[model samples]
Target: MILGYSVTDLVGFFAKGLDQVINVVIMFIFAIIFFGIMNDSGLFKPLVKRLILMTRGNVVIVCAMTALIGTIAQLDGAGAVTFLLSIPALLPLYKALNMNKYLLILLLALSAAIMNMVLGEVQWLV
Candidate 1:
């Protein structure tokens, strides 16, 4: 018994959480489908390819641009969304140039952190 409730009475105690879990699963499913469609449409590949060429294989410029892009992507108000939009678009260039993937992640994370603080959203809410 829990707080005077019988075991049978507590059977449905966790049922509410299942609905929330299912909703999150459905949201992720739709997000994946959307990303797959965008990938197949050739929309992101060309943009990333062009940026790589324009940077002329310079790591400094690429890192700076990655930070900038990551920051701008955060305008959507979600860091996870920013990463989802930025990483896949930038990973190919990082791999092609033999750059450290961790560095790429660090730059984007730092940029996003700085932006979140400056914009007065995440911290202010706390």
Candidate 2:
């Protein structure tokens, strides 16, 4: 026999699903707004400027920095946390230098993977 779910049952199921993730959705919205406000207020501008001077507007420095930060951020062995730490810190620099965002992301991912392997290898060796 086919199961028939009434309107109330469907609505309840939908509400249950929404309730489970409503907090996350709200927090995500606030985070986006916060970052937007910071960007609009130019909070990252000075950081971008300093990075330009330190790296001398070098594309290779951006790549090198991305890899270093990615590896350091991955120390905790959490991809989400690593990306959260690396992306925001590097995105402004990449954009300021007119570099490709995809390249930043690709390099971050590769570095993080290498970091994970190195950590795992050390553990296995021990």
Backbone clash count for every predicted candidate, in the order shown: 0, 0
| Structural RMSD, model 1 | 4.3
Worst 10 residues of 1 by lDDT: 7-16
Residue range 22-118, candidate 1, lDDT tens digits? 8656766787787678767866777767877899889999999999998998876678678777877787679778999999899989988888877
lDDT of 2 by residue, 1-126 (tens): 147988888899999999988976786677667777887899999999999999999999789989999999999987867776677778888988889999999999999999999999998999
lDDT of 1 at 82: 80
- Winning model by TM-score: 2
Taken over the whole model, the C-alpha lDDT of each candidate is 0.81, 0.87
